[model samples]
Target: MEYILGAVGLLLGAVIMYFVGAGQRKKILEGQSQQDQSYKLEAEKVVSDAKLNAEKIIAEAKLTAEKTFSEFKDKQEEFKQEKIRESREKFQRFKDEFKQEKEDELVELKAKREALKEEQAAMKEERASFKADRDEILKLQEAVKIQEQQLEQRNKKLTEEIERARQKQEELEHQHERFTSELEKIASLSQEEARVRLMEDVRGKTENEAMALKREILEAAKEDAAKDARKVVINTIQRMCSEMTIENTVSVFPLDNDNVKGQIIGREGRNIRAIEAATGAELVVDDTPETIVISSFDPIRREIARLSLKRLVTDGRIHPARVEEVVAKTKKELTQQIMEIGKKTVVELDIHNLPSDLVRYVGRMRFRSSYGQNLLKHSIETAHLCATMAAEMGMNKNQIKLAKRAGLLHDIGKVAEEDSELSHALYGMALCEKLGENPIVVNAVGAHHDEIEMNNLISCIVQACDAISGARPGARREILDGYINRIKELEEIAKKNQGVSSAFAMQAGRELRVIVEADKVSDQHADELSFKISQEIQETMQYPGQIKVMVIRETRAVAYAR
Candidate 1:
């Protein structure tokens, strides 16, 4: 029984194992089927989504293509319309121009046709007129031929009468010759000797008459012109005799205080040396209180030094560096001041459009002096004279202004030069040319000093004005010592006279007044004394113009009470 049980158990166990294996295989198959279904569903979803996306992409491409084609079609239509419109406008314009050209050609052709018709008619008329004129000319020629024949007959008759007269004259001449021969024999003098004496007497009378006529004609001509020439010269002199102020080389600068002089001459005189070196001027510190004199052969340097010292003393900042800076600044200011003065002068004279460089050069002349005459002042006086003369002459005002400006600038080059060898005239001309001055001004400047020949009226006028201004009385001066000596000499001459008690030189030594003692000299003697002094002045002194000699005869009685 145990064996049998074991066999059954084993068989049951086998059975159970078989069933379990079968169940597991069935679950495995079911799981594989479910996984296949899931893979199939997932593949279907992917394919559906791919097909939907492809359809959407195709539809969008078609819509975009349609929009692009529509736009291209619209652009083509617009381009066609514009081209047609442009072509139409061009054709219209061409038609209008062609129509206008045709109208013009038609009018011109019509006018030509009318002119041709008129010319044809005129030619026919001319033909007829020419025939008439030719026929008239032929008739006049025939009449002239008849007149010529008549004139020939008259000439023949006149010739015949002349022959008869000539024959009669020959007979008369023969008779006269016989009578003359008889008379000659009776007188016993030949005809040749008588003719010779008659010719000699006629020649002598003709010569005497010719000489007398020549002398009378020459005397009349001389007498006619002399008065006018003298009058012109005298009038010119009288017109130019106006008074002018003389310029002096010395310039004065007032001091702020007397103590400033000590500062100017610093410790060990270093300030003076610095000033002299910087300015190239001689500082004349003399006994004159509250005043300093700047002296130099060069007037420009002297003026510059005077200005610089004045500034330094006024500023009270005296040092070597400050001195140089102030001097430079003062010089610059002076240059500008000169330019301003020059421009002002030109404006006052109505001179226009002067070159900038030439204006500056003219300004430099303010610092220059010629024989104690300020160049600028002399120029102003000369300009006035020129303008007055030019107005009198009815010359152009602009030309007169130019002449005066050139005259004023004639000595501008002296600002840079010291010697007189190279004349300021030539130097000024060169400067003006360099500065692009007017040709007329340059010419006047060059000609004023005789460095060049005068080429125009302005040049001549400028030279004349310079001479008039310079030669005027008290227009210029030399050294003071010389001036004093001249005055003393004149006074001594008047004092040496018998009637003169004292003599005074007046008007800057231009005139002399003599005071005579009344007891010693009578009125008649005073007149004689005046005449004698006038003669003495004229003979002894070389003075310009007429000097007035006044003799004062006064009687005074004085009594002193004690």
Candidate 2:
């Protein structure tokens, strides 16, 4: 009974173990199925995504190809249109060229026809001249024969008259000799003595009459000359005014601060050296508060230096390269400035018709000064003065314009390059002529200072204006030292001449009074000496207005205190 109970218990245990393993295996199978479903869903998702991507790539490729094709079509159309336009333009150009060529040919033909007509007319005139010359020659020959016959008859008649006169003269000679002998006897003197006495009487009467006549002529001539001179001078003076401005050779440049002086002087003074060499002026960098001096004998160069230095200091980029660049640029700017100034001056002067190059020269005059007078301003003033005087003098409108234009350009040559041998007047005239200025204007420019003869009324007007402008007091200022030296030179020149014992330049150097040694210089010789001194002064000295030379030779007999 114990063995049967053990077997039943084992069998029950085995059945329990089997039921639990079956439950676990069923659970494992459900888990495997769940994993399979998950993998299947993942694979479906990957394949759908790949198919959708393939469709997208293919669609994109088609779109790209279509766009490229459309663009290419558009380009092809553009090329076709451009070619058509070019062909049309070429055809039009060729047609226009052909038409122009036809017109030119027609014009040439017409010119040639007219020239032929003129040539024919000239030939006909020449033929008529030859025929007329032949007829004149024949008439001259016949007239010569008639004149020869008349001359022969006159010669024969003159010979007969001469023979009769010779016979009559012989008879009269005998009677005169007898009468002269009788007169000599009555006068108790020889014929020569009596004739000399008669001559003395006649000479005295003639001397008195000649003295009276000389006085009358002198008074009349002086009266007329004074009237004419007074009229012309009064007319010019009343109508004109000239203003002069003087500029110095050195220019002062203002600085912002003292520190910039280093930049201007630069390393080893290269900047300053470059500036000096470029502008032909010396730059004075000194220990002042805030100023630099540009010194040069040439005002234009000094001006350029001052301007360039100002710009460089303002820019604060001072170096050799910067200095050179600024100077060059400033020079161009200054040139342009001069051109503008010249143009405006011309306009203000109411003058016109100047050569373009001459106009540029007029602009150059702004920087040129003569005797402390600004040349450009002087020129403008001269133009106005000339115009006024011309109008007052009853010149025509065209003449007045010419006179004014000439006055404006009269001193253009003063701005010519230094060391040029030509005088300003001649040089300006040459420049005007080269530029095709009016001949009358050229004459006026050259002849205004009497360097050449006055060719027209306008030239005379220019002369009058130039004189009035320069001769005005205070128009020119000579340095005091130079003026004093000039006065000394005048005295020296006068004293240097022979027979001039003492000389004094009186009337502010307008007149020279010379005391000549009476024993050495005669009254007649004193007049000659005065002329010589005047000529010497003219040749060697430069002065305004007239200089009179008076030479006195006094002869005094000492009979005092007897």
Winner by lDDT: 2
lDDT of 1 by residue, 1-562 (tens): 3333444455566556656755765687677765556755665565566556555555666666677778889999999999999999999999999999999999999996797688679869999998997686566556556655654565465456546555755665565556556656777769776446544664455445444544454365457546544654454444333222112445677897788888888876668868887888868788899998776666678888988987888789898788889889988888889789878888887778887776776677777767667788888888888778777888886777776777777666776544556677787788788878889888988888787988888888888888877755566764566667778888999999886789998866767999999988876567668867987887898764577889999999999999
> How many Å off is the CA of 37 in candidate 1?
85
lDDT of 2 by residue, 401-460 (tens): 888888898898888755578998999899888888889989999998899998788898
Quote the positional error of residue 102 for candidate 2 in Å: 66
**lDDT (Cα, 0-100) at 549 in candidate 1:** 85
User: Once model 2 is optimally superposed onto the true structure by TM-score, how far is the C-alpha of residue 280 displaced, in angstroms?
Assistant: 3.5
lDDT of 1 at 199: 47
Q: lDDT (0-100) at residue 211 of candidate 1?
A: 40
Deviation (Å) of 249 in candidate 2? 3.8
Q: What is the lDDT of residue 337 in candidate 2?
A: 86
Tell me the TM-score of each prediction against the true structure.
0.41, 0.44
Counted clashes in each candidate structure: 0, 0
